[model samples]
Target chain A: MSQPGQGLSVGLFATCINDVMFPDTPKHVAELLTRLGCSLTSSPAQTCCGQMFTNTGYFREGEATVEAYVEAFADCDYVVAPSASCIGSVRHQHQMLAAHRPALARKVDRLIKRSLDLTEFLTDILEVEDVGASFPHTVTYHTGCHSLRVARIGDRPQRLLRAVRGLRLVDLADSDICCGFGGTFCLKNPDVSIAMATNKAKAVADTKAEYLAAVDNACLMNIGGILHRIKAPVTPIHVASILVQQEP
Target chain B: MSQLTTLPRDTDGRLTPAPPPGELIDMPRFPINARHELANTDQRNNLQAATATIRAKRALRVSEVPQWEDLRQAAKTIKDQVDRHLDSYLLQAEQSLTKAGAIVHWARDATEANQIVVDLVKATGAPEVVKVKSMVTQETELNEALEQAGIAAWETDLAELIVQLGHDRPSHVLVPAIHKNRSQIKDIFLTEMGQYGTPAPADLTDDPSALTSAARTHLRNKFMRSTVGISGGNFLVADTGTLVVVESEGNGRMCLTLPQTLISVVGIEKIVPRFEDLEVFMRLLPRSSTGERMNPYTSMWTGVTPGDGPQNVHVVLVDNGRTSVLADPIGRQTLRCIRCSACMNTCPVYTLVGGHAYGSVYPGPIGICLSPLMRGLDSPIDQSLPYACTLCGACPDVCPVKIDFPEVIIHLRHEVAEHKIRDTKPHLETTAIAAAGWFFAKGRRFTVMTWLSGLVGRVFKAKKQFGAHMPWPARLWTSARDLPIPAAESFREWWRRNHERP
Candidate 1:
């Protein structure tokens, strides 16, 4: 493993959903970054990025959330979030919020330049293609909505996956399509949610791979839950899980 | 904040009157086949041919202009900057309209907005009104409200007339009757004309011109008779207080010109600050909507045009839930929409289910965002609208305004997930994610959880079904789909056993 001096001094933004709901993502992200010689620290105050309140039409709440986000990560060199939703929010929404809330604008301006999703940070910044991990399994990747559309993190995950030894990357058809997990949309519209999830589940099943990996865990969980319920013999793992892998 | 009105609160503390189509709608079990609409093969063929022909024509027309993308970008930027200062723009729009002899009424939701218009018509002492095709009116169900008030509201657009006469809702924006074939339209025209006034000949055949002629004849009397004209504005210029409506049919021109009193219901987002800005949008709209180089009749009226048009013009600027949408930073981009329906034609999901499945007046990719914004995320139907997409980038590709639809969708999903966590104590998703976080945090726990998952997979081995074994909430998965059982050994276990020598 490369020494910490050569590593990227990445700060994990472990967005609200991943932090409170799935903290393991950040843990894996930190481990993977370490393997790539990325020195990492957890930003404790890096609470919810306010993506939720902002997108739901709560402007004042969104502003407050943006303030809290900027305050938490203001000192970090780089804010790396596990969620494309949060990273996308910081990159896109923060600038808009800055216009309305002038006091917090500067912080947001700085945050935008440094903020990135896990895949983009690892492959692009660290220049680490394949980690020295060996797991001979055929894995298919499902691209999350925000990562692909908002952040435009194209081919970064694929590039990282290509470098993994013994890991055969089988491209899932229509992989860039959403897995139908639109957060509150699922609860409000469970029927449509299932329809979207079912279609994504079918696509994942069609790939005939042992593992289904992606940069965003939200999509994975939705697809994984459906696949798990349907008994599709595929495991859904985060891209960090594979990228951080080391030989025994 | 002082100039802008806070959305009035209801007795329940939520935004008042609730959002439209509030009732729960079950998600379709399977994909809605376009073939179901095949019974109207003539209509289907007409729609397909029309859309395709227009699409090609638009491509040709647009290619001639080297500044097309430049114009689109300028429009988007203007809209973006305006939306950022939306509160000020709305205030300015209201002030300008009020200054120009127009009364401005703020509606918090659709019901309140409809009631305001119905009351406005009643006060005018007019028993009938003529209308142009306006999405805002459709959204507020203004025509239905007028009928409930015992006032007859006439649709002037030939296609809108067909939809109204046949007791059907509009399927497409520009051509409301795009889903109805020529023969079906001829039947509607033959039957409904006499009830309204002019009748088609008994020998009239199902020809497009014959149907149009029948409609023109039937609507002529109402156009001349109605004292009040109800309309929706395509663009309400805040600078000069000019409202623009672009249409191929001359009916809109008649509605504006013939009426004594004109009232236009406009959404808050349609405001363009200046007249010159119309140059950019005017070109983009027709080319994108009808695929025409220019609409045949482009009507522009400012307040009262003396002897030229209606004597009294009242522009009702509606807030509904638009202010709420504007409040959202990520979602604010949706306001940049020009309503060209380019997204609708290119959408794979929309091409299949068409508009009705959306269960809202606004359908397609735009509908998904608009409905939920107009409504709240609380109702089953409104909530379900957002998921009615595959998140393909096709909608964004064709967008003249370049509203990133896929971005808006994921942003909406983030809202949905956050709401679920906040509103409830702990749901299945939260619990499952929480558990995953615990297990995946450490190597030992990860190994143990993987083992447990493998064991559970084994239980379904006999039946080849894992869905049957899932607990409640998670059982929503097996409701329609079946899961394949897991292998006896996991990838990790296999890797450990065989690759140890490496």
Candidate 2:
């Protein structure tokens, strides 16, 4: 597929967790966008879209956060997020939040219409087949719950990864299953949450992948934590991070 | 009643413990070998193929009905209303059933419920009982109880018979032997069926028909001989005092009709306010559960027919923690389940490992929510269930009632935590949470912590462990996952260092 060079200007919304917990994710996303020949800009005003609070039942804080996110991503060609959960919040909840706040609702709807998961934006919108990067390591992909079920993104991540020059993609068993990291769920129900992650870890290990890649970093963190604990060699890398890799 | 002669109620009554409140919480420790079994490629392949086949069939039958969604909404509404007024509905159901000449028994727990049924059976002097597939009976371990009293409980359903003979736990709710493939089933039939079953073909292959026919022949004698039938109701209509049982196979139909005496142990939550309510559930159930537009057998009986089938019908209204589940406002919706395995089948996790990994008879999205409510969140397995999901919305998407399973799971996770705090000492968890709270309380504090993390990330970067650092309980995650080591500077730090005005 030919990469669309025009109409490809993209804006990236690095989730707060990724910003604080793993800043490299957004950095890689920006790098990938640059390589795709899209004029990319990171909106600094975007601290959070209030997903964490809203999911935890703090609607009021979520509303305020949604307003902040809309203001920041207002004029973007397309607002892209690395985390499906964050994008889902903006698409589903922001619309709900906009119901009572009409002014904000109209603004969010405009942005959300053009908003997309990075994989969806890259492969579907930009039509970028391969980013021309090579990492010969065997890797498995996990479809984060939000990306696959919530965002309805299928085969996009794989399509993009398959185009990469040297990546050998081995399918993870139950790749669609959650990594048991529901944000706060990891901290709140640590043991049970870990138990679920262990299963994901085992699945990734079974694939014998050097890297476990997914769209969402929240799931990656939880699975990564479990892998670290068990000392498994599998590395949990965000899809954007992998896509932006250079020939080092 | 010719069927009455075969039931030996006295002996069955003596052996088993009755259904008890929190029976699941105190369940004997199940072996923790689910990981190894789940890794079995053969079982995984079999389960994937089987669940997918049933799901496709269910989807086909259900789509034929244009009003399926409307029926589902109606069912959800009725259930919501019943749950809101459960106490009054239970009393009304009891009064109506009793007035209609059907004896009503109230069971406080599993033991009491089991004893009540056993007492009624003992009163009838039946030595053996033909059983219908009832999740409640399975939940209460009723067959095991009956066996202790030397009253043989014969499983008549195709899947239940396999489970009983195999001496295995029911993995999936609807398809109890879902984890067992045809080869394993053929072997079970071959070995267990001695003279009781038709002689096995010496070289029976893994064809479904061969296995099914072997099972049919094995169960045929039990069906012909047993007089008393013990069953569970899918729905009990309060307005008409009718009990409904929907199944794919014709076994439930035979059990309901051929018996002289019938005892149904039903959860009080199963009550629907009016007979018309059955209209919604009948359509919602078969489609959402078995994915059938309509289940093959849907048997409804009101009280007793003096000369039709069972001369006597007794309905045991079982509480068994249901009242407690109802008492919990958020958790009550779990009782709205119609025992449809749709959610289980569509569930990615449940589909991957099958139901046995949940360590409860009720597995998948519903089980994760229901088990904790019925059993409490004390056991490791029970506590682990809610976290089993990746919070995928697949189960809720296919739910006939739109139970919002993901919402319920997050809620249950909260309950598990609260239970841990109030009931058990959460020393490590509490300490960790407190420590995390202290660190992230303010912007400056968070910034400092992030700064320290960035430094550590650099150390790991030098070692190429980027995206792979974890430090004990947290480290448990890394054994299977790689943590990213942070770059030397964060965006804010980088901005501060590079873009600082000189």
DockQ of each: 0.07, 0.21
Model 2 preserves the real interface contacts to a fraction of 0.24
Candidate 1 structure quality by residue, lDDT tens digits, B1-502: 0111122333434321222233213433122322244334465466556665666677777787799889889989989978887778788877777777777788877898888889988888777788998988887778767766767777888888888777677777766676777788888777756655577878778877877777777777778777888888889887777888888889999898887889989988999989999999988888888778888998998776667678788887787788888888768888888778877766545543456566666777998887677677876556556656655455786688888886687667556656766874676655554444444434344446556767866775586555544676655545544444544454444434543455
Model 1 vs truth, CA RMSD: 10.2
Any runs in candidate 1 off by more than 4 Å, and if so which? Answer: A1-248, B1-69, B86-116, B171-187, B203-206, B406-419, B422-444, B457-482, B487-502
Residue by residue across B126-167, what tens digits does model 2's lDDT show?
777888999998877778667665666878888888877675
Per prediction, the TM-score for chain B is 0.81, 0.89
lDDT of 2 by residue, A43-112 (tens): 5556665655455433445666676677667878888888777887788677765679788888987888
Per-residue lDDT of B26 in model 1: 40
Cα displacement (Å) at residue A177, model 1: 7.9
lDDT of 1 by residue, A1-248 (tens): 65432645676676654543344566677666666665666643444665554554344455665766676677777888777767877888777766866667877887789898887776666656655666678999888877777778888888878888889988787565456666544444345556567678888899899999887777777788778767799998888777766667
